[model samples]
Target: MPSQATTAPRVALVTGTSSGIGAAVVEHFCKLGHQVLAVDFNPAGKAVAGKAGAVFYEADLSDPDACRGAVTEAVKRFGSVDILVNNAGIQHVASIETFPEEKWHQIIDLMLTAPFLLTQAAWPHMRKKGWGRIVNVASIHAQVASPGKAAYTSAKHGMIGLTKTAALEGGEQGITANAVCPAYVKTPLVDNQIADQAKLNNMDEQDVVEKIMLKQAAIKRLIEPEEVAQLIAYLASDAAGAVTGSSFNIDLGWTAH
Candidate 1:
């Protein structure tokens, strides 16, 4: 059981909460008794928020101003943010040579810049209260590499850098910043990727999963979003106060070899 004080109705801001890992994290925090602010541009977010009993904010995090607005809205609705989960992201598939400039900018802006801006806005409040948790939902791609995902990889890599810097600055103020980097999780995002990889590699969906996605994993299976949510819940807990500036991998041994 969670402590009442630790699991009390603290304000939490979770981005990209319409589906996948983001949605799972929001639901997990809500179950722990936190008042969550779920932000996502997806129309499904409203329904998810209702189910989770969390306040919802619909906004495109790719926009810097929208990122700031998310923080502002969370503050207004929930009083002060005790946890900020930077999870809004999208994937673009293309090699460096063929990657569209616009798509590159969009991915960077959304996956990397939005986290920076949101953290910036939330920092003062966290600093003032002398307690905070910032969890960046990065990818294993942040450390490893795959073909046709330069923009996605770069953005995730940048998130790790931001996590370290913020952790250094916020340590004295009782704020902790860390990232969770996972390999392919069984989400709608990865479901879409199955078809994309099939077309890209001229293979069937099963072949793509077997020959590509799980080929590097020692576990030979995709991770579940709930598993990632459990890790986020731990990081947000007071028990994890000493863990900061770390990239905890749930990568199924992808990086082992």
Candidate 2:
């Protein structure tokens, strides 16, 4: 009844679009004839969105007001945020006792609280339209944990909880919420982690990824950003209408063990 997913153009608000999976999502959605509002804290995101033919909004989502403002900007520019992708995040590696209090709070605020605020801000718009899709980009750590990643793991785990809650609340209103938990992806974010991982493991940077990051992965390789983007697109499409309250793992069999 709703027609195929690509028949109509939906407005999408995607965060962390300066590079990596965020940029890939922007490009993919735009190619599907959707209007996209690309939000990122990095000023360079303006250029990335321009290249992708998406409107760009720069905001530090850790700020509660900024999180709400991002959704407001999307509605202001594209009429409504028909699709919301909570994909902006960062990683900090340290033992629980050694992790800085400020960093932990920042990570939780940005990765966990921001998504909640954004969802709250977008809920009314979606309810009014009787249709919406929410995709949270969680990680393999959401379901499992590793040492020296206290804040990152905690926030990702929280994200899956938020996704489930949103799915439950949105079900009767024609909105669906889901999370994609991917293993290490070939993105700048993961690349940035290599140094910290190497330092934490006392290993060479190259060996850190091969011997550590992908060691448990049956595929023995990092996922590409575009690959994760494809899964997010599918979850956001009308074809996935029945798929809600689910956490799909793109972990290359790492979780299969």
Candidate 3:
């Protein structure tokens, strides 16, 4: 295999940079001296990007055009996009019968289709440069199932398929694709889910965390955003040039059983 040819301070385009894992990834890459284009639909992402010394692009990633445009904007700003992190996602919990069709589309589009579009847009640049890293932030749900997460599970599972395909096609060109499947992380998203779960189950938030979210894990704690970010940083680095088409689980032993 060809050695990773991308030079130092490569440009990275990360989606969903407004908060949680996305914000942490932007901060990590920026701290590593890489030029980062932080894309998020949230206006507050501007502050995050600014504080991290990254350029911010506000766009709804669910929009197909916005996905492609983000790649263009990154290249226009930084000359080339050497790393792409598809991390934008939203969760809607509902039974299959009660899940809204529009909500399903929203989740699939943002979490699944957006990554494909962004990857398609970034492929040529990476092919030309002979090096690229594409990290798809999947979930433990990608490999497992939850009762009310029909759409989320489907999208994450599809993300792994996308990762494998990209890895196979990009392997010879020095572009590696991988997925990071993290269990519940300490983020606003999970916090909101905990509140909702507590109300639904008539239990305290702490109980929901201990009995519901971490039930399968031997280690009973939520993973931190920075912890996940460290793994993502490793997969995105040239040191992981040969690690492709695999899903690394940071599931706090959730899948051990």
Candidate 4:
């Protein structure tokens, strides 16, 4: 549990809150007494949000208008958004030579473009309040890459770039922006990827897990969603105001090499 002062009640808007890291983040914030706005296309998001005492909004983040609308609704319901977590993303694996053009566009739009628009929409509100926290959930792939993940890797890299630039711009206003880069997390996303990789490479799911996913981690273990959520909760708090324009890694030493 986070300290009460560190989790002081604030209005937080977290995208991709339906499950995994995003859902954990929402729950953490609510436990810290923050008013949360949970956004996701998943129908179950509303129930999850309700349980966390957060207001829920269902929308496809790939749509720029929907991203903007979510921000608008948050402002209307909460008066202001003190924190924003850009966590919605998707993965499509294929070699560069054979990657589908449509998949490339969709991945980039959802992971990179949506964050840009949401940040743009929320900027003025944060500026008015003179305090804000924006944490982008990037991946270790933001700095390192593996085969068959060009679209996912590129979008993660772009997210880091966006985080840095936004941090620089928001610093003068007491608003902070940062990115958290983590390795394979034990989430539905990774579970789905394991199955997808098994089918794609004609290997057993266990082989995919051992031979591919954990091959590079020093710990050789998947990270828990709550672990990443704890870091996010810290960054979203008033205590992290000084920690901006940076990429913090929770990759179990994957990038140390």
- Residue range with the least summed lDDT across 10 consecutive positions in model 3: 1-10
> Against the true structure, what is every candidate's RMSD?
1.8, 2.2, 3.0, 1.4
lDDT of 4 at 206: 81
TM-score of each: 0.96, 0.97, 0.95, 0.96
Instruction: Rank all candidate structures by their TM-score, best first, as comma-separated numbers.
Output: 2, 4, 1, 3
Tens digit per residue, CA lDDT, model 2, 49-160: 9998999999999999999899999999889989999999998888887899999999999999999999999999999999999999999999999989999999999999
**lDDT, model 4, position 154:** 94
lDDT of 4 at 79: 96
Tell me the TM-score of model 1. Answer: 0.96
Cα lDDT tens digits for candidate 4, 47-123 = 98998888999999999999999999999998988899999988877778989999999999999999999999999
| Pick by TM-score: 3 or 4, better one | 4
lDDT over C-alpha atoms for residue 162 of model 4? 98
RMSD of 2: 2.2
| Candidate 3 residue-wise lDDT, 77-108, digit = tens | 99999999999999887678888999999999
**How many clashing residue pairs appear in each of the predictions shown?**
0, 0, 0, 0
Candidate 1 collision pairs: none
Which residue segments of model 3 deviate by more than 4 Å? 1-7, 199-204
Per-residue error for 205 in candidate 4, Å, reads 1.8
Runs of candidate 2 with Cα error greater than 4 angstroms are: 1-7
